[model samples]
Target: MSLPPTFDPVRALSLARETLSIEATAVNAMADRMDDSFARAVALVLGSSGRVVVMGMGKSGHVGRKIAATLASTGTPAMFVHPAEASHGDLGMITAADVVLGISNSGESEELTAILPLIKRMGVPLVALTGRVQSTLGRHAAVVLDASVEKEACPHNLAPTASTTAQLAMGDALAVALLDARGFKADDFARSHPGGALGRKLLTHVSDVMRSGDGVPRVRLDADLMTLMREISAKGLGMSAIVDGEGAVLGVFTDGDLRRLIEKSGSSVDLRALTAREVMHPNPRTVRADALAVEAADLMESNRVTSLLVVDDAGSLTGALNSNDLMRAKVI
Candidate 1:
């Protein structure tokens, strides 16, 4: 059968605009309603020495998982326990040291309510995020976080649209508050997300991925040009450092320098008599071994080079890291 052409586009657009406006207003209302109870909920989770167990049913459970993830990543240890699973022995996961955060817009989900008594019996501090302050779960909870909204964004007023959004926003608020309260920093966050780019940027050090010792292409300042060429060819770094008797990096001879030297004095000239100090570029770009790999990559990119010399606090050569090393570390 052919689709009807008489569908009202104007009415559909009007309803869409009305729903968006209503949801926007509802979120603003929820933000305005945040009070001391919200603070209490955050404090309860923060003070708990054990994990925060979040439990709910349906959409609330889905929102609870996201809340638990946010809390866990932001330094507040948290995990989600499905209400149905809690009744089927998962409740054992809840302990007296844990703080139970229960989410239910109606505050009367049977599956969620069924395990409430057990949570209470375990002496777990209860923090409820619900629309009704007088609801059973809210009344039983040690802290009642009001996530009430005026109406559902759904046209039929049945789907959990506005309520879930409000719940998610409230969860974010709690996570951020706890993050700031606990002084959680980016480095701490990186530790939890070690596989992510942020971890590569923050946790990686120059020494961790750098080429070091004999693997670092280098030559004594008095070495002949031919010997320097041999060092560069064998090391595969396309450049060789010129060093003093004490092993201090004096300068560098690079592929670009070789090109220039060839152009100025014919490549056929005997290079053995030439000293490394005569052809090496003095004071090459360097980075401390402990510096972040991101910084090293930035230095290499800014200076228009492919590699960086890694040095100790006293300016002694510790290693050498190239752009490829940063790529391998995922710092790029």
Candidate 2:
């Protein structure tokens, strides 16, 4: 659709919508195209003891890399090897135990077509994702997935737009199906992505990030004002955990508590006589050392506290941490 000489935001928006609708239609068409081929491809990857080796070139290579990453991060062990690179002594990466997934919009990339026979000769199962099922790569594949598209989102319809999108969607579908077959969970995903936010939320325990042993600011319940002040100052957490003789956390005394005590006592109050149990906030919020660090962060935020005392199941102090600790660990 062409706009008139006059500028019109509505007309421009309509053209954008038309592009999206065309791509969406392409993806929907692929749903009906799914048949025994997709099933066979899934079975090949799932049953393989080795990895799912994905091969592609150009834009298909970009999509293939992401598909390989998704599959590996999910439950399937997958890797991407460029077809051109594979022909140049990289074919050794594939073995008889592995299954090869080749992606090409036209199914006739000379590089991919050239390597199919070698991969097959090695007794590796070949699965092809292509727009043309009759092309050379498709003809050589044991399983042919029809990743056809009606049109490209590009105005000239020359670029691989909708076709690449279909390939990506189909790859994601296959990965998720294998993930379900293996009963992959959030914890399993986190194991593969330990540095990501989701991994921190699911895998980083309090003990992994909290200050332990002497690093924790702790004082006995019978400790005097001077002792509590020194522990809090030395820890620089603006707080101290008050524990019983057995190391069980009894209460928490923060800078806020000191301010409140000063307000109530005014001048001429005896600081030397004060004890942790007298001014400390008893039964302070606590988290287990083995708990997720994200859980500790949530506890601190909800309680409006800067630090928390880490405890074991037996209610003994094991560690301590403040908001800064969570921030340092990138758990905040």
Candidate 3:
């Protein structure tokens, strides 16, 4: 691949800036031109009981796939079907209960237009995202969304640049409107994207990541400092809970407390003779096992602590967690 003989750095930069300006203008113009048609389109899909079937060709088809994904993730059920493939028996994917969203800058792609009559025969409502509202695709649609652009960002004005931008912006507008109407929330979006970070934060609970049973580091309130230190070392949590006979957390002691204790007492006091209750920090922050993992992170952060005692409704210690546990779960 060789640079064109006419390629100048200054010219390239200017052209890039002009391209962005043209696309931005196209989107802004579309926003200003929005009318009741946009709302009606939203209402049309909302009223439907079936999924939205999206279809397009070429670059428009690529944009259609993205729109479908965005809609699905945002609570609207949608999928994209290739227009050319629809001609070869893929039209069976459409159902009378579904709404078809057709995308084309010209509104006259042969592959797309060829299926308009079949879609009409099936009685599936059509929503057109096109530059020309009077073209064949628009004429067959029950609701028409004008995604028209004044000109292409391409210097030749033949490529699909600003036109495609307009279509994408219009698609996003429709998805957002539908999402709001449906009362879609972050949790709903996370459900569709369970592999993403938001899902982990919203869906993962403290019990899922906390150390349970013997994994929890704890010592009786009457235990000596040596026993407490041994428990903390074995669990490797940097801390041990001071629990009563019934397993209720009374207090906690960490390596930091040990260092501070040694610094304050020096060799003047016998540190080995101290009891867990006497050395532990009372009223340590605790989190409910049912709480979200992100909530635990927030509690730890606000309290300037790296660990938390997991308790049940009765305040009985059920488990424990540290910053390392959260990091391992990717919830931090």
Candidate 4:
């Protein structure tokens, strides 16, 4: 019986690292090759009134789906259609206004090439990401992005590996460049991704989670300290607004203030004799009711305060918000 070769983990790691280094070098080389072709490709997609239709096959199809998703999330409207499916009547999904971005390493993928003439007949512009610039698909394309790799990470040079990675990165580059060209803002991204954390931070407003009017824990400036406690507990906000006869916020008294006051006075006993005005912190940090939730969070952190009264442009108390509100809004 032949003896089993001894395991060499060190050699295995070195080879893996070498593969990654080679792939990195290949990607760096592409940066220098980027030229007018990239600009033309961007112009074509930006000028199109319809979505960018991305199509590929096998591993290329998987990469295309991700590229489509990235483009869609970053302000470019795009969708993936499998080439095999396109031959089965999915070709109808492509419109004259659209731009087709076909990805194939060899640029000779039969399924993708088969649909080229039909797409051209419909007047849809084609962008090809391929290694072979002289291949049929590249030759037919209106713009070709060279995603060539010198070698595959696969020891036998059979797997896609480095080629696919380069394609994915190139897709990202297009999506980001298009995003900037369109002046797509964080708020725009938030609208498309309302369920994501970035959406919450950018879309949530002070009015969305603030306690308004009677819901805000507030007591008249003349109210006793005992009345203040009742107001805070009743509203469950751990703080009470000290308001004047005009209902304008004069100051705020928080649980922290009460604790400190109690410690200073050497008594947690009856203090109803003292009014809320005497113990409140004047001119507490405030936010406008129309301010972004993220701004409110910033104010809270910078002021070292947990809560802020929401006021209108006229300085009239409109609502109240706390760190808990920001958390609930996912702005934290």
Residue 86, candidate 1: alpha-carbon lDDT = 85
Identify the leading candidate in terms of TM-score: 3
**Candidate 4 local lDDT, 1-332, one digit each (tens):** 76459757888898899889878977887777989999999999999999999999888889999999999998899999999899999999998999999999999999999989999889899999988888988999999999999988888888998889888889999998999999998889999999999888888899998999789988888889998999999988889888787778889999998888888887655676899878888987788988898898898888898888988776678899889988877789
Error of 3 at 93 (Å): 1.0
In the range 1-332, model 1's lDDT, one tens digit per residue, is 87578778898899889888877887789888788888888788878899989888999999999999999998999999999988999999888999998999999999988888888888999999998878989988999988888899898889998899888988898899999999999999999999888988999988889998789988887789989999989988888888887778889889888888888888677666788989989999999988888999999989999988877776777788788888888788
- Residue pairs in collision within model 1: none
Steric overlap count per candidate: 0, 0, 0, 0
Residue 223 lDDT (model 1): 89
**Model 1 segments more than 4 A misplaced:** 1-21, 264-273
Worst lDDT 10-window in candidate 3: 187-196
The candidate that wins on lDDT is 3
Off by over 4 Å in 2: 1-15, 267-272
The TM-scores of all predictions, comma-separated, are 0.91, 0.90, 0.98, 0.94
Task: Report the candidate with higher TM-score, 1 versus 4.
Answer: 4
lDDT string, candidate 2, 267-321, tens digits = 8889789998888888989999888999999898898888999898888988989
Provide the overall lDDT of each model, using Cα atoms, as 2-decimal numbers. Answer: 0.88, 0.90, 0.95, 0.90
Cα RMSD, each candidate: 2.7, 3.2, 1.0, 2.7
Better of 1 and 3 by lDDT: 3
Stretches of candidate 3 off by over 4 Å are 1-4
- Candidates by lDDT, descending order: 3, 2, 4, 1
